[model samples]
Target chain A: MKFTNFLQISILLLTLTFLNYFIVYQKCPAVTYDDKTVIHQLSKQNVNEKIFFITPTYSRPVQEAELTRLSHTLLLVSNLRWIIVEDSDQKTLLITQFLQRISKMKIFENFEYTHLNVETPKSFKTSRRDPNWLKPRGVWQRNEALRWLRENTTEKGIVYFGDDDNTYDLRLFEEMRNTKKVSVFPVGLVGGLMVEKPLIENGKVIGFNSIWKPKRKFPIDMSGFAINSQLIHDKHDAYFSPYVPRGYQETHLLTQLIHSINELEPKADSCTKILVWHTRTEMPKLKKI
Target chain B: MKFTNFLQISILLLTLTFLNYFIVYQKCPAVTYDDKTVIHQLSKQNVNEKIFFITPTYSRPVQEAELTRLSHTLLLVSNLRWIIVEDSDQKTLLITQFLQRISKMKIFENFEYTHLNVETPKSFKTSRRDPNWLKPRGVWQRNEALRWLRENTTEKGIVYFGDDDNTYDLRLFEEMRNTKKVSVFPVGLVGGLMVEKPLIENGKVIGFNSIWKPKRKFPIDMSGFAINSQLIHDKHDAYFSPYVPRGYQETHLLTQLIHSINELEPKADSCTKILVWHTRTEMPKLKKI
Candidate 1:
């Protein structure tokens, strides 16, 4: 090729490459539509890896509100399969309506989801007087999602345990999307500390910044780590057990999922910044109107 | 100019214009940065219009969680200036910490925010048995935000009243960004109805879908509308009044701001879809350890 012609073609190629990058990361802005029914959302059409977001929820005064807020945030993320396991024998109307309404929007037209219900046994439930942390909650609900994942698909994806009320930064999903083993990040306002994270040494998970249960093997919150779907398939016996002691659920799950703590991949700039928060919504006190 | 040269230049101009549209309507993906510091958000740099989002927040068990979630959503939008007014004698440490920490993040590098406070008088505050509708709420706090906006800027912008807890669709901001006058959209789950919105005729707001107090001038939820900042300048006395009867605060403000109901502009696909929701957080029941 002539030198001048090569230079001109090179410039065009570079422009195309940069613009392609711009489209994928900026979130493809939803296409404009006259009818709100066919609205679109900024999407990740160029990316291939998917996320399986598992959430356990129960009926509460703010259940609809919490789910609605959470659904909006989740919609911002692309390539996500929302697997909501309700803490009830059957899926409630509130959640069904939420999903159905959200699915009707054209912006979320391609959004994938699964709604399931498996009630937590009464014996495992926390009493009004007892502190909520006294028992390991969502054991059965999460297990049901796990059973679904194993039985339903052999797809390669990332599995994250998300809370209905917790705050999530969109960047958190981007960091977790590439998890090779178990990707770990910081959880803010957790365990009375501003942040709890896996201490990274040369990008290896050496220890944790947790003050509570410092002696536990994993020493992480449930929101702290995301596993490759391969881990779930590899460890059929891995499950969240209610029989474990308080604050041991994370350690128990991590023990079964990994060969060693070193297998953890540190994300969100090696846990220097918190991408998730362990936030709990207050139960509202109400009167029958 | 030669016809052949003019044709080549015209083709190039067309390509540039098309590329600009793609970059804009397609959200410009944030640039990559290795440091957790100096992170960037998908921004609307090409658009000139700005949204001044005024939010009223108070101390509650879920206050931090609510702010964190709302902040994340706001960070996704470009050209937005957040004005937060606290319902307290002075801004609480919790809110201070929330803003300061968020400001430190690079992903929110270009985010603009203002925080102020004004206490709700004892008479205006609702008691536990008052059913929350007995007295007007957020009147003083929202007024404080308005005063701040008027004092701080002479820029042409759209002003919106937002709550710390309500669910917001990201598209809601885009719909309101170009308001020439009052722009209204549907609010979901409000006033014991599934959706409440401005009834549109031709292109103007003719009436409303409200079941409660349909005769009111602007029978809409507080989360339903946006105004051009010029309207705030035009209506000096237009403010959310505490003296209004139950559910009349919206009507009271609209009465001052508009000369005729014909000035109202219908948005969010002419009020066909719910872009905002009146979702309240459940107060948490916590036991002292």
Candidate 2:
């Protein structure tokens, strides 16, 4: 009777183990790849410096729609990795599933990405009714991406803050690719100006042409600049600040990373042509169910 | 001895049954709904007539992006059902999963949709090199939707052929909802015309303002017309022709459905406003992997 009991217990344990394995297998099937397939395609780029597009995003009604439009534009470029940091306590299954589906597409087969989530403190978070410009958002999320880059990346690359809602022209990526230290460009439809541009004199960025507040050292939007990876790595303590004033986020962060104003390299034909736009989609009126 | 054998077999059967049930339950969990939940929201609309938007789409690099944009616009309207027919041999998992996600959103909680796939014949399918106008597309897919509507839908409704690539203003849906018979409107940037419009005289469509072959009965694009569901059911065999001439698609189908121009109801403020655009997204330039 003792032998039979032991035998039944052993059989039950074996069955449970096999069942667990089968369930896991069904949930995540094996991904078959050819011999030439590079799992992380960003590490295999032949360029002198890769471009890391860091976008800090949050959950909203238009989150997936905005990402879909942006992904279509980004998929055209080469040697680029998208670092998407979400504003959530934990990584949501919706976003993870979306990123996985996009990554599997043939057009994005060579694309590389990293998904990170860092929740914003309740005090710093703004209400939905607040105007976007009045509230300083994406501060901690951007810092988290910068922190990840500093800890994981050692190779040469460029870091750019690409807001999900902004419209990007393909030529802007090419300009950032050749960035040596810090590149600046013209951003259209921003700061109540036709173009908030980097004022270039003698092929160097002297000042900014922003109409809102030209008093700051670097009066540019988030999409207006790109920093070299080496510079970011060298300046270990530089990151975006949440305590800064409404419009001082850009200036406050740039001052820490750059030793002098001369480090700013004007791009997009000496900041004469607008290659990017601060265009925002109008909120769709959804009827109450 | 026989009684013991029977007991052993019963135990084995029970164990197998429990394991199978556990595996199936793990694969697909249940979805809970409250009393206020709207399962088939399309059937709950108070409107006398529903609008069925039939869109024939194929898998492309920008398929999801285009569909997402279209969904944003369509979600704003009430009493509408989107019939997305895929031009493939079988329904793809990608399209099915995409529809499921979109339908679950709060903004689209009331949106209803049907997914169907009908493969284009090998001989008629055009290559990528061919210009869009040269190839007659969406012929069979539209027919499949019409057939489904005839067989499945018995209530009063309006059927409109909406292309996935076009841009629709919200006002267009309101105009289509009040369609009496075959509603005619102006489609902007179509057939190399600034606006292919219906020339109204005394609240009736007299002719077309189209520069591209105005001799035809209805010189408008696919997005410019909406037909009553009852008329389609009465015709019994009316559908788009795959063998029509390069520019005769709209005319060939309209002639079969409408006996005279008097039956057309001019909409969108007497067909003056260009509420929809025949806009297309340019193909992204991606490097070969």
Candidate 3:
């Protein structure tokens, strides 16, 4: 009788073990979707060209806030690669970790990205007292992106210098995607004008409406233009200059890429609509006490 | 011998059960901190008054983006009660879910909030054809907040109308906290002027320097003023008027709350600093095609 009781207890224990495993399996199923699935979905269409938006970012109090805002806008576009170059001595753990988290999100999983860092030389760095307009920002970082495009990319794409703080319309990407050589559009709230636009007459680039300094051959902000990757690769030595006069970075780079003014294609309904803004966030005052 | 063997097996099974429980406990511990704990820490140090920041928010494409940015600012402040009144037919699941997630964050858990909704009547609502400036927005919602304040609280607090779209400096909160009767400060990028500030002379509110319609008794934007809660409570019937002319809501309400110009206390380094801007975000153009 004692042997019989032992057999019954063993059977009961075995039944309990199976029940527990079944419950756990029911509660915790495998995750069906992941980063690879998103990428597969995006690649299925097989688009010919993509937009490589190169944004040179740096760390500050509002760094994450600005990046978050910009990311929301960038994620809305399809067939785009985000290349974020950091102005740091090395690839910091913060940015690496940030990119890892962003890549895991549903919104960013499908988008291709390359996170790089190229530190600015001490002599080239601007001080707080210096006016922002005089600072030669994003010089080395932009060059790194250009170098990356030349080395790694053979596929058709367009390169755009998208600032972390600037506002962009989805329409701007469509214009840039259609560019054969270079494209220009109106940037609002910039250069002391309602819009620093490419003055187009009868579907040709004529002049500019930049009130701050209209005399420059290409008077525009960094957010005002885009260039085809083929053109960027063709002009091997073309890069933003660190020694240019105040507000001449756009003109200096454009002059190197384009042979004549006709190469500039005015977009956004012949440059009438303002699709981007050089909007800068005012630094917030933090009290230590 | 059989009975002895059964006892040994039973003891072994019991030991395994205890070990399993221990492993589960180790793997999944209870959350150490929560929203209630954060609120407790903030309220531990008792103060004479608190700040009641009333914000009237509506759903738009940029609603979450703007609120996230604003929450970053508002969360940094202590002793603040965020009254977010939504402009909708009913309290939305989206807003409620957003608030639940936000309130649980480490940064915002300390702040208290009330999420309320009151839809605008069809007649008073602005159409797409009407310019944003011409439409009298936030009238009924502001009054709903006022009613909530009167019905719910008896404690001494300061009330400030914080628009969701505007940029705010942390220093602005400190300035608003020091107001006795009513406080006014310079608002940046407002009324077609660099600053819409009060013209103070020898510590008196003489007049305003508003470029647009400076003739009004109190020519200021919604973000330019903060009033004592007692003054709002004392004048029980005072609320924003829906029938008021365009841009007259500020003047119409301030007229009821204050008896004389001397009652206005100028803060933020005697109103020289532009701590807040009436900054508006341009709508992004999305292609339906």
User: If both were scored by DockQ, which would come out higher, candidate 1 or candidate 3?
Assistant: 1
- Lowest lDDT 10-residue stretch of candidate 2 chain B: B30-39
Q: Candidate 2 residues B160-272, lDDT tens each?
A: 99988777755576678767669999986666665778889999988887766767777878999998888888887888889988778878888888888889999999988
What does candidate 3's lDDT look like per residue over A15-118, in tens digits?
A: 66556555543322211222232222333333356899999998765565566556546654566888999999999887786665444332322456799999
TM-score of each model, paired residue for residue: 0.63, 0.48, 0.50
Question: Could you say which candidate leads in DockQ?
Answer: 1
Give me the overall lDDT of model 3: 0.74
* Candidate 1 C-alpha error for residue A204, in Å: 3.1
DockQ of 2: 0.04
lDDT of 1 by residue, B125-217 (tens): 988777766877889989988888788788888999998888787668878877888888998777667677888889887887677788887
DockQ of each: 0.15, 0.04, 0.05
lDDT of 2: 0.74
Candidate 2, which CAPRI tier?
A: incorrect
Range of the 10 consecutive residues with the lowest summed lDDT in candidate 3 chain A: A30-39
Sorted by DockQ (best first), the order is 1, 3, 2
| Number of backbone clashes in candidate 3 | 0
